[model samples]
Target chain A: MHYFIELFFSGLTRGAIYALIALGYTMVYGIIGLINFAHGEIYMIGAFTSYIVASVLSLYGYPLFATVIIAGAAAVVWSGAYGYTVERLAYRPLRRAPRLSPLISAIGMSILLQNYVFLAQTSDFISFPKLIPDLPFMDRYADYLGSSDVVILFTTLIVMGILTFIIRYTRIGKAMRATAQDSTMAMLVGINVNRVISATFVIGSGLAAIGGMLIAAHIGQINYYIGFLAGIKAFTAAVLGGIGSIPGAVLGSLVLGLTESFATGYVSSDYEDVFAFTLLVLILIFRPSGLLGKKESQKV
Target chain B: MLKLQNLRAGYGNIIAVDDVSLEVGQGEIVSLIGANGAGKSTVLMTISGVVSCLAGRVLLDDVEIQGLEPDQIVRRGVCQVPEGRHIFPQLTVRENLDMGAFLRRDKKGIRDDIDYVFTLFPILAERRNQDGGTLSGGQQQMLAMSRALMARPSLLLLDEPSMGLAPLMSKQIFKIIKRINADHGTTIFLVEQNANQALHIAHRGYVLENGRIVLAGSGEALLTDPEVQKAYLGI
Candidate 1:
């Protein structure tokens, strides 16, 4: 029973991290109908940005919490800037081109960003500073739940709640939904569609950045290549729930996380990737549109 | 209030609208009637800046607006209810109306306008919270018109407002169009394939054929004209 409880909490922590990254994929896909392959690199860049800032601040004798906050803010801003630039340089010019064109451009961008990071920073796995401190009250629950796990879960919950509010009631949120539904009509109604697209990229990248920082702190190490595997897993989560639905991404991530945890706990950790991919394949075979995805119902 | 001179525009390589010149006076209902392949919608799209103008000038109150973007044109008081009543399918009817007022910052005025549109189409009021995709065709048309009205446009460009609707619903839409013009003193540029109904409401009308304006006159004159009757009205 203790083992099961431990696995469950671990699953929840993993789910929380995956949810943060999956949101970026789902949102970008929702607005533009393209899989932004470069999104994963944005996550990596976020991790690196936070890593550099946290290290510098810690070296300068800043308080732990302050270092964490400053590093997080820096990560978000830089990731957002990169996201905005990627859209402008890579996707915007090909907006009217064939759908396949932008997709190719996205893949190219992902490779370019990965190489750029590789050249700029060392490929070695640098140890990350533990930004989340061990809370005093968590000593009793330390056997099942760590302080970092609690922080990850709490942050994810708050972020999702805030995101829901923005999408439901805010003006720009309405504009994003409107553009997703019918961009032409959105323009007729005076929405700057380009600006909305840029905003989507920035917001999505920011979420990925937060995920990057949290996971780096939790694992205590990060490298330029960390984003590749994490990105694929989160994308799988997004596709599992429903690529274009917001809540679907979170649900999918939790499911994926729990499945990986239990499979590893019961069987072996060596087959973790096998289990994740097999589950995705099974889901695809059974429900091609995804668990929560609406079947294509285009009006003729 | 709106004028187009020798406007040329089309999808790449194939011209849809060529040398089309027309004028719509302030507070007047001007209808452009044509057959299926004629460039009526293209003309309106050119004015709205959805289709880029390849040549010539689009003047709104004598200011050139040919090269402006679609949203820019809307900001300048030109709003289009495109063909097929392209309502944002996932949005509720009230939300659709809110999108119509996307650029407006006046909260109280937006609220009053919402109330006014609800009154204009009481059916829309009932379906205020329902997703726009779930509405019936005629109801969708009502929502589309109401959505455009939320902008409080000075010159409203309507593309095929009566298309794909039953005769009764078409009559209702036309009546509401006239009421909107009379009530708001808004100039209307209406494009329609249903010539008889459109001409009846229009103060003046133009007949477009194969990207060219072949005829123009008072609506009553065009209605009685033999050429228009044979080609368009089936009279």
Candidate 2:
């Protein structure tokens, strides 16, 4: 029972991070129907940005909580800039080309960003600061969940709630939903479809940055290569949830996280990646549209 | 209010509207009537900037808006209620209407327009909270027109507004279209397959056949022309 409880909390924390990252993938896909293969690099950039900010601030003797907040904010801004630039420079030009053209461009972007970071930053792992301060009282419950896990879980819930509110109530949010439904109609209605797509990437990449920062804090280290594996897992989560559905992406991430946690806990950790892929394959075989994806119908 | 001069447009290389030229005067209802493949919708699309003009010019108030993006054209006071009433299926009727005013920022004016739209189509008011896709065919058509009106456009391009509608509903929609033009002084450029009804309501009309304007005159003149009487009026 204790082991199960421990694994559940761990899974929940991991799922929250995955959900955050997966949202970027799902939203970009929802609006533009592009997979945004370079999304993972955005996450990596977020972590690195946070690391740099915190390191620079620590030299000035900033405390842990303040450092964490400032670092997260810096990461959000940096990653958001990257997201907008990637959409404008890399993806925008290929938007009207063959669909496969953008896919190739996205893959190319991912590799280029990865190498860019590798050359700029070190290939060796960087030790992240302990953003979560030590809580002596919670040490007794450390086996069930750490203070970092609790922070990650709560922050994710708050951010997700805020995101839901923005999408539901804001005018821009309505425009986004409208554009996603039918861009031609959206354009005719006077919504700038290009602006809406850019906004999606900006918001999506910001969320990914938060995810990257939180995960870096939790795991105690990050590297340029961390984004590759983490991004693939989050992409899988988005696909599982239903590529275009926001709620579905969140649900899918949790499921993927729990699956990975339990697989690692009970089964050999060596086969963790194997188990995740197997589950995705089985889900695809049974429900190809994904768990919450709408089945497309031919209008004509 | 709107002018097309020697315009040629199409999908890829296949021309759908070739060398088509027409004018829609301010505060008047003008219509383009044609057969199934006569390029009626293409003409409107080219004017609205949805389809790029391969040649010639589109002048909105004589500024030449040819090849501008659709949203830019819309911002310049032309809004198109496209064929098939493309309402956002997942959005409520109210949201769908709000989307029409997406580019506008005047809160009080937007609210007033919503009230005005509701008055025009009371059914939309009743189903304000319902998803637009759930509306009946007639109701959807009403919603589509009302949505365009929310933009407060100077020139409203309505394509096939009466398509798939019952006679009673189509008549009601036409009455409202006339009312909108009269009350708001909005210039209308209508495209329809129902030639008799379209010409009956329009102040002037053009007959488009295979991407060219084969005939043009006052609504009554075209309605009574021998070729139009035979080909369109089915005399």
Candidate 3:
């Protein structure tokens, strides 16, 4: 029972990271019909940004909490700029091109970002400093739950609440919905469609940055390639719930995380991702629109 | 309220609207009739700034609007009820109306206008919270018009409002169009292949054949013109 509780909390914490990243993917895909393949790289950039900020600020004798806070804001702003640049340079020109064109461009952008980071930040894993006050308990949760699991669960809940507020009540939130629903019509009604699209990418990338930073800080390590596995996992979570649905992404992340954790804990660890892939395949074969996505039908 | 001079535009290479010139005075209904390929829709799109002009000018209330983006066009009080009733399908009827007033900042005025739209289309009020996609064809048309009206445009460009409805529904839609024009004192630029119905509701009408205007006259004159009745109106 103690082991079960520990695994459950651990999975949820992991799931929260996936959910954060997945929200960005799902939101961008929902409003603008592009997959935004370089999104993963933006998260990697955020982690690196946090690293640089933390290192610089600590050298100046900044407190750990202040360093993390300042670094998180830098992550959001820089990642948003990264998203805006990608939209302006890569996706804007091909807006009217064939769907495959943008998809291919996204993949190319991903490769370019990875190599760019490699040239700039080096390819090897680096130690992520302990920014959070993690007082590890060897037996506090061993009899009830794991100490790491508690931090993971609590942190995600706070992040989720903040995200939920931003997406629900803000004026920009309404604009995002209008842009996603019918862009042409939205444009006709005096919406700056381009601005909204840029805003979507920025917000999505910013969120993914926070997720990447959290993951790096929690696990104590990050590399230029860290985004690859996290990206795939989060994409799976987005697909699990429904690609365009925000709530769906969150639910999907939890489901994916729990499934992977249980599989790793009880069954063979090697089969964890295999189970996720299998779930995706089965869902696609049976419910291609995803578990929460609505099917669009043409009037013609 | 609106004028177009030598407006030429297209999707890519094919010029859809070729040297099309037309005008709508304040509180008048001007209809453009043509075959499917005669560029009626292209003219409306160009005026709304969705399609760029190769040459010529579009003026709304004496302001040059050509070369502007679509949203800027709407801000100039020129709104379009596009072909296919492109209301946000997933949104509720009320939400669809709210999106129309997206540019407006006055809360009380917005509320008043929504109530006004519901009054104009009572059936929409009854189904305000229902998904826009669920409304019947005629109801959808009314909702689309209401949504456009939420923008409070001086000029409303309607494309093929009677496209997919039954004859009875089409008649009702035309009647609503006439009423909306009369009550709101709005200038209308209507594009349609339904020459007979369109002519019935216009103060003046023009016929386009092969990307150019071939006929122009008062509504009654165009309806009775022997050439128009024979080839275009299908008498």
Which has the greatest DockQ? 1
* TM-score between model 2 and native: 0.98
Candidate 2 structure quality by residue, lDDT tens digits, B100-167:
99889999999999999999999889999999999999999999999999999999999999999999
Model 3 misses residue A182 by how many Å? Answer: 1.2
Q: Supply the global lDDT for candidate 1.
A: 0.93
Clash-forming residue pairs, model 3: A141-A145
TM-score, every prediction: 0.98, 0.98, 0.95
Candidate 3: residue A34 Cα off by (Å): 1.0
lDDT of 2 at A18: 94
Misplaced by over 4 Å in model 3 are A135-139, A142-148
Candidate 1 vs 2: which has more DockQ: 1
Q: How closely does chain A match the true chain A in each prediction, as TM-score? A: 0.98, 0.98, 0.94
Task: Rank all candidate structures by their lDDT, best first, as comma-separated numbers.
Answer: 1, 2, 3
Candidate closer to the true structure by TM-score (higher is better), 1 or 3: 1
Ranking by TM-score: 1, 2, 3
Q: What is the lDDT of residue A73 in candidate 2?
A: 96
Model 1 DockQ (Cα-based): 0.90
lDDT of 2 by residue, A116-222 (tens): 99999999999998788767887999889988888899999999999999899897888889999999899898888899999999999999999999999999999
**lDDT of candidate 3 over B1-235, digit per residue (tens):** 7888887889888988788788899999999998888888888888888888888888877889999989888988999999998989878998889889989999998999898888778999899999998998889999999999999888999999999999998998899889889988988889988989999999999999888888999989999999999987788
